[model samples]
Structure formats: C-alpha cells, structure tokens
Target: MTDQSTPLAPRQRISPVSRVAEIVTSSPVVLIASIILLVVVLTALFAPWLVPHDPVRLTPSVRLKPPSETYWLGTDAYGRDLFSRILMGGRVSLVVGVAAAIFAVFFGLILGLFAGYIRWIDAVLMRMVDGLMAIPSILLAIAIVSLWGATIWTVLIAITIPEVPRVVRLVRSLVLSAREEPYVEAAIAAGSSTALIMRRHLVPNTIAPLIIQGTYICASAILTEAILSFLGAGINPSTPSWGNIMAEGRIYFQINPGIVLWPGLVVSVAILSINLLGDAVRDALDPRMAKRGIER
Candidate 1:
C-alpha cells in the first residue's frame, strides 16, 4: 500500500530577473555590447534636442578651437561645433545603415521567394546573383554612385544593391530545403496553392536567420557609406555625416586630431556593437550551436 502522507512536489519557476542575470553572466560580451549600442542609438535619435549648438552653424573666429567649457569637442576648421556635428553625424550614419539594410532584405526576400519556389526561374536568377557577387561590392557601389550622382538616396541604393545578392542566396537556400520537407510535400499533396505553402510553411522558417543577416547588413552598409563619403562619392559634403566629418578632418588632422578621432571612434564602436549583437543572436537562434554548447 502507498504511504498516506506522501507529499506532491511543487513546480519551480524561474523569475524574469534571474533569467536576465543568467543571460548576462552567460554572455557578458553581448551584454556590454548591447549597452554600448543602446547608448549610441539613443544619442543619435535625440541629437537635435540634445545638441548644445547647431551642428552646421559656423563662427569664423572660433575655427579650430580646442576642447573648452564653451566648445566641448572643440570647433572644426569650419568653426562648427565638433561635438554637435558628431552627434548629428551619428544620426546620418544610422539612418543610411538601417535604410540600406531594409531595402536589401526586402528585395532579396521577394526575389529569393520567387527564385526558390519557381524552379524555372531559379537557374537564371542564381546566375545573375553569381555575376553580381563576382564583382567587388565597393567597386560596384562606386560605379553606381558615380553614374547616379552622390546623393543620400543614391548612396543608400548603391549600398543596398551590393548587399541584396547575399541575402538572396541565403533565403533561396532556405526555401529550397524547406520546400522539400515532408510537411511541405503533404501540403502539396493536399492541393494547396504554391503561395499558401510558401507563406505558411517556408517564410516562417526564414525570419530568425533573416534578422541576424539584417544586423550584419546594417553594419556593412554603415561602413560602406563611411568609405564612400571619405572618397567623396557618398552623400553631399554639406551634410553632417561621420564620413564627411572624418574626410574634412584629414586635412587638419595634425592641427586637430580630435576631429577625426571622435567620429572614427563613433563609427568603430557602432559597428563593433552591432556585430557583437548579431553574433549573440545567431548563437541564440541556431539550434546546432545551442546543442554544441550543451554538449560542451
């Protein structure tokens, strides 16, 4: 006979704070990177209100002034407040990066969906993707910007086109494998339309990978924009961008290294933070990686 006084065990629950602490301890690098990214993003988003002076407003007498109570990061050769311009430039860099990534991912998703789902078009589209990939992306971007003229929109387009092929290949491969799954085949046997099968079965599988891809694309796009602008082929020089700021500072670098130093640091930190976040996300989303971690 069973003992009359046998007690049932209570279920243990993990609290949100404990879960957060576990994540932070398990991936301290990602936690630090996330904090850095958050601070940068917030500063850029509120730059207009947070800026001490107009980024573009100039004072001839104050040109090239060193850091002071009045001029925090000093004045550029153009006499604009270096601190304010840096803040504003962050806005431009982030905007271009995010916009280019979105354009690339959106077009890539559509083209990949069609190419992978429609067997007849796959060969032609994949070949086109291959040809694009063969060319050095920076050179291709330069050629496009040269023809289109160096405006903000053109820079965004140039950055996006080069990135699309990478996304297309990833999405296409995912769709190809996913479409052959037993569930997908069963859906086909049920007389489901191609659209329904792709929408319901394939697209959902692509989201996690696409999100990680998007972060990398954003980091690359930002770096590309800086390179193009430094080469005088990106957004107009009049605009306050990290690239433009660094480009201008090169001439007066010996006199005021701070000008180049500040903006360059901003770009470096932003890219690093983004890449770290992407790596962390990839580890979290990839089941194989999680399995390996557990095994270790």
Candidate 2:
C-alpha cells in the first residue's frame, strides 16, 4: 500500500549529448584544434567582406606603409593591401593543400586495394612504394616542378606524386589486416567476388586510418607548396601565396620584420592546428585509447 502506483526507485535520466560534451570538455588538444580550424574557416568565409581594401589593386604612394588606420596589416612593397591579400591568399593555400591530398589519396586507395587484394600486384606495388620511400618528398616535388614548369598545376601534381606511395603503403597494410577478419572470411566463403568483399568489408574498415592520413597529407601539402613558392618553383610570382609573402618578406626583414611576421605566424598556426586535428582524429577513432584518455 506504500506506493503501488509508483516505482520503488527513482528513475535516472541520461542525456545523449552528454557524451559529446564530455569529449569536447576533456580533450584540450581537440578543443584547441577545433578553435584553430574555426578561425581559418571564418577568415576564409569572410575574406571578401572583411578586407578593408582591394588586395590586387595598388597605391604606389602607400607602398611599404606601416600598419595604420588605412591598412591594418600594413602595405607590401607593391603597395597592395596586406590584409586583403593574406585573406585572399588563404584560398589558394587551402585549395592546393586539399586538392593535392585528394589526388594522392584517390590514387593511393586504388593502388592499395589492388596491391592488398591481388597477389600478382602485391610485389610490384611494394617495390614501387619502396622506391618512392627512398626519395625525399621535397626533392621529388622539386624535380617534378623543375620539369613541368612552375605553375599551380605543376606544383599540385608534384605534391601528389610523392604522397601517393606513402598512402598506398598505409592503406595496403590496413587492407591486408582487414582481409583476415571474420566478416571478410565469411564473404569469401559465401562466394562474394573479391571486388565486392573489398568494397563492402575492407574499404569501410580502413576509413579511419585513411581519414587521419588525409589530414596529415593536407598539412604536408601546404608545407610543400610553401617551400616551392619560397624557392621560386611554385605559383606565379604575380599570384599571392603564404609562401610568396614570406619569401618576399625575407629581403625586407631588416627594414620591416612585419613582412615576415604575419605570414609566417599564419603558416605556423595553420600547421600546428592541422597536427592537432590529426591527433584528435587518431585519439577519437581508437576506442580503447579514447576510453583510456577519458579516464585519465
């Protein structure tokens, strides 16, 4: 008679979003990475509206002017608006980075799947990957750019060529492991085609590593593009790039250190953020590690 209608115990409520909140709150590196990425994205999205002056248009009299009311980030030697150009240049930086990563990963996955799945292709793929591993990526990129002529396409292709083999090796290793799983074996026993098993079982399982690698490749691509531009082997001098900005700044470091400061700072922050993002992804994707991290 005490509480026939009501339960003896009080019901406990749990929120689904609590887990997401816990993750964001506990992971300082991830939170910082997210913020850094957010800053870049916001800057890119508002570049056209945010810049006070035309990036490409020049004012001869105002060339090399210091930071002031007229130009927040100061003028380059060309008298073009520094703030505008930096923001606009981000578009190119991001484009080259992302495009190169995609190109490399696409080719990598195809090669990796064939290499991992087909016995005949395995030796050839491994040998090619090994050959690529012997050469430093920067040197390879430099050689390719030298031959293709210094243009955006050439730079992108150069970046792609070096990254593909590394990605293929990583993916091939993953696929080889995945092929041994019960689901894969079941598919094989059920008479599923190799292509179907790969598509349905192997590729999906390899997604996590692939995603982490893609981000790393993107960061690397940016660095590569910057190096190429700095050395006068990348995008046309007429165009603005983070690297070109820094390259030009090196000459004026004595007169106006701000030339090197702004672009260099941007590059460092960008690369750091990308690394942080990679760490976050690696942590998140590994369940055992995530749980251990959360506990710690």
Candidate 3:
C-alpha cells in the first residue's frame, strides 16, 4: 500500500524525434504535407547540381516545345527548361521567404521586448507599430521595392518590413501578460536588471508563440515575393523565380498552360504545407488545445 501523501515519480520528457513521430503518425495530413515540403526543400537546395540543362540557357530551337524526354516539363517562351527553372526558382523563393521571416522575427523580438518591458517606451513604440500596420502590407512592399529597385535583397526587405509590426505586436502582448506573473514580480523585486529579467523570465514565454508565428510569416513572405515578382516589382526578370516564371507564361497561357500551371501548383503546395505545419505546431504547443484533445 502506497502512502497517500507520497508523490509519484515525474514523467520523463519526450525526445524531439519521438514527439515529431507522434505528431506525424497521429495526423495523415501532417504526414503528407511534411513529406511534400521536405521534397520541395531538398529539390530546391540541390537544384544547381540536379538541373540537367541550364535554367537560363536559351535554346530557341526548343522554344515552346511540349514536354518531351529531353525537356521533362517543357520549354518556355525563351526555351529555358521549365523543370530546371522551377528547381532554381524555388531556391530563390525559399531564400527570400526564410530570410524575411528571420529578419522580421529578430527585429520584432528586440523592439517588442523593449516596448513591453519598459513602460516609458511602450506607447511610442506601439504607436509606430500601429502606423506601419495601418498601411496595406502589399502596397507598402510595392512602394519600398519601387524606390529601392527590384533585387532579391530589396524584395526581402520589402516583405520583412510589413511583417515586423505584426510580430512586434504579438511579442508585446505575450510580454505584457508574462511580466505580471508572480515569478516576474519576484525577479523584479530581486534587483535583476531589465535586460536580465527579460532574457531569463520573459523571453521563454514568447518562444512557442513565435515559432508558430514564424511558419505563417514564412508562407506569407513566399506568397508575397511571388506576387511582387509577377508585378515586376520583385527580383529581376532575368532571374528565374517562381513568380517570374508564371508572369512570363501568363501571356502564352492559351498556347502552353503547363508553364504557368507547374509553378503555380508548386507555390500552392508549398504555402499549404507551411500553413498546415504551422497549425500542427500550434496544436502541439497549446496546452489548452492538448487538454481538449483537439485533432487537426
């Protein structure tokens, strides 16, 4: 007979691989999305070596040629290999999306920490964030790109600027709640420096939410870059980004729909996978959702 007051042994923490395996096995959608995203990312990363023909090489003889054994996907207006171009284009899209998300989160975390922890700067910082948020993100990005010129870096900056405000707001809200907790108050009373308290006490509370937010931001950034490229406000047309591919093919859609369809399909799948992964992460992280046994 066990003593009534005796505490049970603590459960061991699950390994990250085990946790991921559990998530994948429990959800078929998550499994499929994860596989597709993994394949796309790997294909993009290895594209330079994997491509059979030069993505930008112009073979006028093969221009507008339908899918063949030589050109697996087909040829575009300039006879660039659609398959090679797509693989290379994905690298650009992934780079921009990932870099933009990282920058946005990094800058937003710093600003939000300052704004939420220091009351003196809270109103001022929030006002600036509000001003940025007031403008439409797409319009703001276009304006920035137009002024700066259409380069990969310029497009990344354009996408990142609009996204920072949202992240700042999210972090600020998280900090606001966390700072009021008893542990935070105890830290404050213990003569800890503002920076120390923020780093030790506040930052951890924001990590889970930030991870979930980052996935959405990455997806949005990818879509936004594609839109910008399509509108001639993004990467140089010479560069074979997914957006440029679709934009070039739009005029020839009636003749060769595959050019546009292929890139568009890839973009849709990438974004959908990212979003679905984000949802899975959210469900896994949220204690309330876990307690409720929510499955999606």
Q: Candidate 3: where are CA atoms >4 Å away?
A: 1-7, 15-17, 292-296
lDDT of 1 by residue, 31-139 (tens): 9988999999999999999999999987998999999998999999989999999999999999999999899988999889888889888989999999999999999
Instruction: List candidate 1 segments past 4 Å from native.
Output: 1-25, 291-296
Tens digit of per-residue lDDT, candidate 2, span 199-232: 8998887787887899999999988888888888
Number of backbone collisions per candidate:
0, 0, 0
Record all residue pairs in model 1 with backbone atoms less than 3 Å apart, i.e. clashing.
none
Question: All predictions: root-mean-square deviation over Cα?
Answer: 3.4, 4.3, 2.3
lDDT of 2: 0.83
Task: Count residue pairs with overlapping backbones in model 3.
Answer: 0
lDDT per residue (tens digit) for residues 52-98 in model 3: 99999999988998999999999999999999999999999999989
Against the hidden true structure, what lDDT does model 1 obtain? Answer: 0.90
Candidate maximizing TM-score? 3
Q: Tell me how candidate 3 scores on lDDT.
A: 0.92
lDDT of 3 at 85: 99
